[model samples]
Target: MNPLKRLASQTAVYGVSSVLGRFLNYLLVPFLTYTFAPAEYGVVAEFYAYMGFLAVLLAFGLETGYFRFRAGGEWRPETVYGTVFSFLVLVNALCFLAFLLWSQPLAALLRHAEHPEYIGWCAAILALDSIGALAFARLRAEERAGYFATIKLIEIGANVGLTIFFIYVARQAHEADPGSLLGRLWDPDIGIGYVFIANLAASALKLLLLTPQFVSGLGAFDTGLFKRLIRYSLPMVVIGMAGIVNEMLDRAALKYLLPHDDATNMAQLGIYSACYKLSILMSLFIQAFRYAGEPFFFSYAKRHDAGRTYAVVLNWFVLCCVFLFLLVTLYIDVFQYFVGADYRSGLDVVPVLLLANLLLGVYVNLSIWYKLTDRTLMGAGVSLIGSAITIGLLFWWVPVHGYMGAAWAHLVCYGTMVVLSYALGRRYYPVPYDVWRVLGHIAFGIGLYLASRWLVTEQGWHWLVAGTVCMAAFLVVVGWEAWRLRRGASAIPGV
Candidate 1:
């Protein structure tokens, strides 16, 4: 089979889990928005933001490290997996112990002093998720997409189911009969805490389901291999953490930087986060692509024509992202209904955030250079610079312009990183990406979006019709370009 075809197939399988699972999980956004006030949902958002940071810390970039060494044939796959697994187990054990000893202080620091259990639940979720990170990476490396999709679906389904039971059935039952068993089991005041609990249960269940990987993949612990993996992954940890800050700092920063009271601040955050979900289509595609693309890129690295392959992949990725950007932005009138009516105030940020995520996806594709060339430190440096810009902008903007400012900050930060990464990648490990065509796609997509916005001045069916035409036109152009490229490549001797 063609390498790109194999990659597309694997991405489809991964998408079954990532895209479908996230679509299923998207249900939680509406449920949470409707069930709780924006402030309550903000608590959920903020907690998860912190989880994003902790998760990167706990995994310590070992998944990527495992992929690099294992794929490069530097060590036995089992030995690498075992080393990563054992190291995470030790780190998580220590983290859990520390959480136990200082849960109160930690809770206080997170502004959840009244509900310290939230901190503990988050710690457990992070630890379990970290331990399972290597296991999931192993499945990807082995091309066990079926098992991966199955486990991911189970976890997402369970999480959605549990959330409904807690928020709708059990909570309503308790509300109806405060003296009943359901009332004893459900606490109305727990409010958004149920979100965390549902995640905890689902993560624990996922870890349980992945026990076979833990058992079979664990081999003799080699301290030398462990040290080597750590050395390689340490910079990745920095990159991952900084990357998280770029992705999530806005959500987390809103709580502190906004001048409003805590409740008001959380309400703004909830609105921002809900609108952020409007970009789910772009995010899901990027995620699915990453899951398949990472291993695909690593494996392709050994090929004589890997650079051309990567360039093609990057072209398609940008094209897809641009299409998604138009799809969502043009039909945002309908997608806005995905969140609650109250959260709709922040709908304007959706396009900015979508474009930001698009840039981020491009940056992820460009990152192939650093990972393939073992200049992981350059990736870290790029991310740290991005993180600094993100933090500085959030502190400067969130206080003044609110979530809209944060959205722009996100766009600017990722956009800058994409440019920097491309420049550095060209200098260090050139991939001959079709730069002009990629930029043309982006410019054309934005042009169509802007045209639709200007032409479809009124809402209702007029907007929908305009959007559909714009989307179809964009697709037709892309299809034509793809055909042209294929013909052009065929004419070339070795393309």
Candidate 2:
């Protein structure tokens, strides 16, 4: 099979898991929005934002480091895995211990001082997830895409099931009487605390499921391997921090930046979070693409005309993202039902955020230039630039405009990073990415989407048909370009 075809197949298999997991997780939006007040949902959002930052710290960028060293072919696979795995175990242990020691102050700082258990439980979840990172990375490296997808879907399924049982069933049990199963296990007043518990349960289950990866083909721990992996992975920690900050600083800053009190801040954030979930379709593609693309890029970089090959792949990546963006935005009136009625107000942010996500997906695809060139510091620089832009905008705009400010902040931040990476990639590892053609596709897709929206209702099956046609038109243009490239390649036959 052609390399691209193989990648596409793997992406689809992985995407099955990704798309389904995201869809299942998306179900939580309506459930949470309907069950919890907006303020309560905001609490969920903030806690998850904290979880996001903690994941970066606990994993310590080892995922990217695994790809980097494993690609370099300098160490035994077992040796590298053992070293990194052991290090993560130590860090996770230390993280939990620190959280135990500081949960009081941390809760106070987070303004949930009475809910230190939230911090403690979340700390445990982060630790388990961090320790399990290598096992998942190994699955990716081994091309076990099916297993990877299965594990993800299983986790999502478990989380969703547990959440429903806890919130809907357990809450009712507690409400009717104190002497009940849910009342015994949970405090009825702790509205959003159950969300963390559900996640912890899910993470623990995922860890248990991945136990076979830990036990199989074990190797003795190596100190030399540890030092090397740390050396390579440490810069990525900085990059990961900046990257997470870029992605999350707006959400994190919103409470502080907004003029509203705690209740209103959360109310605004709840709306933002719920609407943001609608873009998970694009996020699913980006994630599945990353899982398949990282190794694909490393392998492709070894090809003689790797730069041209990368350019070709980049075009396809951008086209898919742009097409998905149009599809989501054009039929957003239908998609908004994914969240409950309370969140419908934030639908306006979807197009802005969807475009931002497209830029982010493009940036991820473009990042191989720095990775392959061993200029990973450029990644740190790129993330810092993006973070600065996002933070600046949040402080300046969010206070006045609320969620709309955040939407624009995401666009500005991701767009800056994408353009900067491309400009620098040209200087360091030039790839002939068809910049004009890619932008033209984006412009054309947007135009077709607008025309479709003007022609059809925003809800019902008719909306789906119109959005599908809009996306199909964009794909048709890309297919024509691909055919022309194929014909040109065919004509260059050797005598």
Candidate 3:
């Protein structure tokens, strides 16, 4: 099989679970938005955003460390797995204990003191997810995409089923008839608390499904080797923490930057979060790309012409991202139904955030340079710098401009990181990337987007016509470039 095709097959399998799973999970957004008020759903959004960051901490970047060491090839797979498994078990146990002890205080800090169970539920979810990190990492290392997909799909399916049972079927039944299914499970006083319970149940389901992988990895505990792996994975604690903080600090900041009223602030945050769901498509693509790209990068690092291959991969990434951005922006008129009517007011952030994510996807691709070169510290430095910029902008701009400021902050921060990574990459591990052609594609995409934006505003098929034209232009350019590269016509010398 062609290498790219093989990679695509793996990506599609993973995407089945990752992309479709996320899409299914996103089904909750509309469901929750309509079921609960925007402010109520906003609580779910904020808590889960924090969960995303916490999952990073609990996993501590061990997945990346797994890929690196697995590629290093100095030990048996069992030894590597054993080492990682033992350490993570100990660490996650400690974390769970800490969270259990501190859940009430943490909830108080987040101003959810009356609902301390929310913190406990999220903490449990994080711990479970962290424990499964090695199992998931093992699947990726072994290229067991099919198994990985199956496990993830099952987990997502279970979550969706339970959520529906809790939120839709149960709640509606209780409302319509007191003797219905929801009445049995419903506690009217708990209100939206069942949302967290459903999530907790689903997480425990993931733990059960992961049990086999966990057992298989622990043939014997290699204390010495475990210590070595810990040393290597420990730095990731800082890096992952910093990276997650970068992603979630905005939410933290936004809470304060907005008014003191919980209802008002959460309403705005709800809008922002729902608009963020619009960009989840981009996030899905970036995630699937990372799954495929990370292993591909490590496996092919020793290839004589890997640098050229990296350039090719990056160019293709830019092209695909631009295509996704255009498609989403153009058809957003229809996609707004994903959120509730009240939330559509924030739809303007969709385009800005999508573009920012496109830039971020590029940054993710470019960042592999540092990883492959074993200059992971460079990544830490770059992310820290980007986080600083994002935090500064969040404080400086969010209060004045509201959600729009958050959108621009994401764009500026991600854009700066992309440029910074490119600059530093050139110095340490220069690849002949096609800077001009990539920039041209971006510029062309911006122009086409602007034109479509203007032309689509009129009545009767204007959007359809404008969108079709823009899409065709994008595909034609991509096709032409693909052909040129295949023919070895180096229009941009190094490219």
Candidate 4:
């Protein structure tokens, strides 16, 4: 079987969990938007933004380090897994202890002084999630896509189910009968905290389910292996933290920088965040591809033709992302309904965010050079540069243009990183990526989107029709290009 086909198959299996789970989780956006005001939703969004940062710190990049060394078959798998697991346990324990001591100050800093419990809940959730990261990475390394998908779906389903029950059903029950048991369990005043509680429950459950993997991987710690893994991963921690800043700091910055009251600022953030979910189609695809691609890339790295394989993967990845970009931006009139009417004011940022995420995906594809070559310090440098740009733009733009500034910041930051990574990769470990073809596909998608924006005046069935035609044309072009690539591949002796 072709390596790319195998990867596609694995991605599909992983997507069964990622795509479906995210789609289900996506339903919560509507539910939460309808149940809570924009300010309340903003709290949920901001808390998760902080989680994105803390998660990076807790995991410390050991997941990728494990994949790199484990795939090389130099050290025992148990030793590698145990080293990462034990180290994470110690880190999280220290973190939780600090959270306990500084929970009040942390809550005050985040403006959640009224409910410091939110800080504690977030701490627990991040700790559990960080520990679970290595366990899940182990599954990926072992090629247990089925098990991985099952565990992921279970966690997502539980979180979504619990959220709905607490926010919708239980709240209504409490409103109707304050003296009842359900009412006692449902705290009407704790609006957004319920979201955190639900996540905490789900993450704890996931860790419990992965106990077998965690236990089996436990062995006597190897200090030498631990030191080596940490050395490789230390740069990744910086990369991961900087990457999160690029992806999530916008929300965090919006909370602090916008010149408005707390409620107004949160409302603005809620709108931006809900609209951002419109681009999750592309985000979800990138995540599923990452799940399958990382291990696959490492495993394939030993082959003489590995560069060609990486180039082909990058091409197809960009092609799919461009298609998703066209699909979402063209029919955004329909997808806008995913968020409530209150959040639709920020819908214009969807396309920009989609393009930004597409570029970020390409950047991820390019990043394999640094990871495979063990020049992860270069990855860290690139991410730090992107993060610096992102922060500078956010400080400059969010105060002036609001969330639109954030949208532009995302595009500029990711685009810069893509160009820089490609340049550096070419110098250090060239992958022969067809940069022109990738750019052409992106240009074609953008042209179609612009044409649709110009031609489709009405927002009714006629607009949908025009968008459909545009999407169909985009698909046709993609199919033709894919066929051409396949024929070219067949002509090669061993692709």
Candidate 5:
């Protein structure tokens, strides 16, 4: 099979789990928003942002490291898996222990001193999630996308189901009859904490389902292989942590930087984070591609035409992203229903955040340079640059313009990172990436969206009609571009 097609097949399988699973999980946003006020939901948002940071730390970047060495076929797969998973088990255990021990102090620091269980529960959730990442990575390395997707969907399905039961079913039952058997599961004071409880249960169930892989990996541990993996993976930790800083720091910072009372600030944070769900489709696509793309990059790195393949892969990746961008932005009037009316206030950030995520996906493609070359230290350096910009902008912007500033901060950070990665990539490992054409795809996508907006607002065209017409035009443009690329022509050649 063509390599790109094979990768897409893998991505589609991963996407089935990631997109479908996260979409199912995302369905909770509206429910939660309606059930809890913005300030209440804000705590959920902040804790998840912290989870993003700790998750990268706990995984220790072994997912990519596992892929790199395993694809090289030098070491036994069992040995590689054992070395990575065993160490993760140790790391996550310690993390969960620390969170349990110092949950109060951490909760106090996070301004949630009243409910330290928030700290403990989120920590447990991240620990399980971090451990599951390597097991999932094992599936990818073995090309078990079907199994991977099945487990992911089952886990997410359980999470969504349990969440509803705890927050809705149990709550309603308790309200009707406090002495009912299921009523004990519903506690008014616990409120949004039930979401974390559901997540923790689901994560544990996922780990249980992967017990065969875990048990298989735990005993074959090799000291020498562990050293090799650590050496390669440590820099990945830095890169991953720094990447999380760029993607999530805004949420962590917004509450402090908003220059308002705690309640007002949290309300603002809740709205921003909830509206963030609108951009989840783009983020989910980037995530699914990462799950598939990283392995594909490493496995194909030694090919003579690898650069061309990377370029082609990126072109298609950006095309899909721009398509998603238009899909959401063009029909945002409809997509706004994904979040409750409370979150619709921050809807302006949706397009900005989507475009930022598109830029982030581009950076992900460019970042392959460092990973393939084993220059992850340099990759970390690039990410640190983005981290710095993100911090400075959050401090500088959020105090002034509020959540829109946070949105722009994401745009600027990713845009700079993309440029830096492309420059550094050309010097370290040049790829014939048609980045200009990729930008053209983005620019053209934006233009089509604008024209559609104009059609509805100025020309008085029906929105559905305008959206359909423009979407069809964008598809025709992409079709033309693909045909030209296939013909080895930048422009139409002689018939």
Candidate 6:
């Protein structure tokens, strides 16, 4: 099989799980948005941002390290897994212990004084997910795409089902009649905290399902390999954490930076976060690509035409993201039905976010150079540069423009990272990426979206008709490019 085709196949399998999971989780969006006010959902959003930040810490970059060292083939797979797994357990255990000891202070500090259980649940979810990260990474390393997809689907399915049960079945029932059996099980005091509880349950269930990997690595720990893994992977922690800073700092800053009172600010965040879900498709595809791309980049790095292959992969990636961008922006009204009317006010930010996610996906692809060349420190540097932009602009803009400012912060931050990563990628491990073509696709997508909006708003065309015309035009352009690229294709198996 063609290597690009093989990577695509792996990415498709990963996408099945990720895209489907996002779709399933989207069910929760309507459910939560319709049921609770934006202020309520904002709490869930903030806690998740916190979880993302902490998860980067707990994983300690070991997944990438495992892929790196394990690719050397000097260590047995079991021993490598054992080394990573044992280290994760130690890290997660200590972190969870700290959460348990001071969850009260932590909750109070975060202004959730009455619900320290939220902090504890968040900590546990982070721990379980960090370990599960390695288990899934192992599956990717072994090319166990079927197993990987299956477990992801199962975990997401469990989460969706439990959320429906807790929020729809029990809570609603209790609201109507508080003296019943299901009502007795429901706790109004917990309120939106059920979101955390459902996640905790889902994480626990997922860890339980991954018991095979957890149990298999128990006897093979190697102190020497472990230390080396730490040294190599620690920079990745900086990379990962800095990446989170670029990604989540906007949300974090929004809470404190907004000039409104807490409820109003939280309400604004809830609206922003809900609309952020509109970019879920773009983000999910990027995630699926990362899952497959990481191992593929490492394993294929030494091949003669590897650089061309990587370049072509980025081309396809940009086109896919462009299509998604147009798909969402051109037909945003249809997508708006996914959230409640109250949340609709912030839908304007979705296009900005979708474009930002496209740039983030590009950076994800460009990151291959750094990871492949063991220049992760440089990667961290690039990410911190983006983080600084994110912080500065977020502070400057969020208070004035509110959530739109955050949306622009994301766009600027990711756009800068893509440029920096590409520049650094050239200096370190040069790939012949089709830079002009990639930029053209993005420009074309955005232009089409703007044209479609004009048709709908200015010329008074029906939105559905305008969206259809715009989408068809974009598809025609993409198809032509695809055919032309194939006709001129000269990226053979070897130099």
The digit string of per-residue lDDT tens for model 6 on 1-495 reads 677778989999999889998799889999999999999999999999998899999999999999998898888888999999988889899999999999999989988899999988999999999999999998999999999989888888888898889888898789899998888768989888888888888889888988897777676999999888988899999999988988887776678999999989999999999999999999999999999999999999988888878888888899999999988888888999999999999998999999999999999999998888888888889988888899999999999999999999999999999999899888889999989989999999989999998998899999999999999998898899887665544445631
TM of each candidate vs. truth: 0.97, 0.93, 0.94, 0.98, 0.96, 0.98
Residue pairs in steric clash, candidate 6?
A: none
lDDT string, candidate 4, 404-482, tens digits: 9999999999999999999999988888888899899899999989878877764434778788888888888989999
Candidate 5 contains a number of clashing pairs equal to 0
The Cα local distance difference test for each model comes to 0.89, 0.82, 0.80, 0.91, 0.90, 0.90
lDDT of 3 by residue, 193-217 (tens): 7777887888788889888887765
Model 1, stretches more than 4 Å misplaced?
Answer: 458-461, 488-495
List ranges where model 3 is wrong by over 4 Å: 177-182, 457-461, 488-495
Best by lDDT: 4
Q: Write the per-residue lDDT of candidate 5 for residues 183-214, one digit (tens) a residue.
A: 88899999999999999999999999988878
Cα displacement (Å) at residue 59, model 3: 1.4
* Error of model 5, residue 181, in angstroms: 1.2
lDDT of 4: 0.91
Q: What is residue 330's positional error in candidate 3, in angstroms?
A: 0.4
- What is the alpha-carbon lDDT for the whole of candidate 1? 0.89
Q: List the residue pairs that clash in candidate 2.
A: none
- Count of clashing pairs, candidate 3: 1
lDDT of 5: 0.90
Measured with C-alpha atoms, the lDDT of residue 448 in candidate 4 is: 89
Q: Which ten residues in a row have the lowest lDDT in candidate 4?
A: 486-495
Candidate achieving higher TM-score, 4 or 5: 4
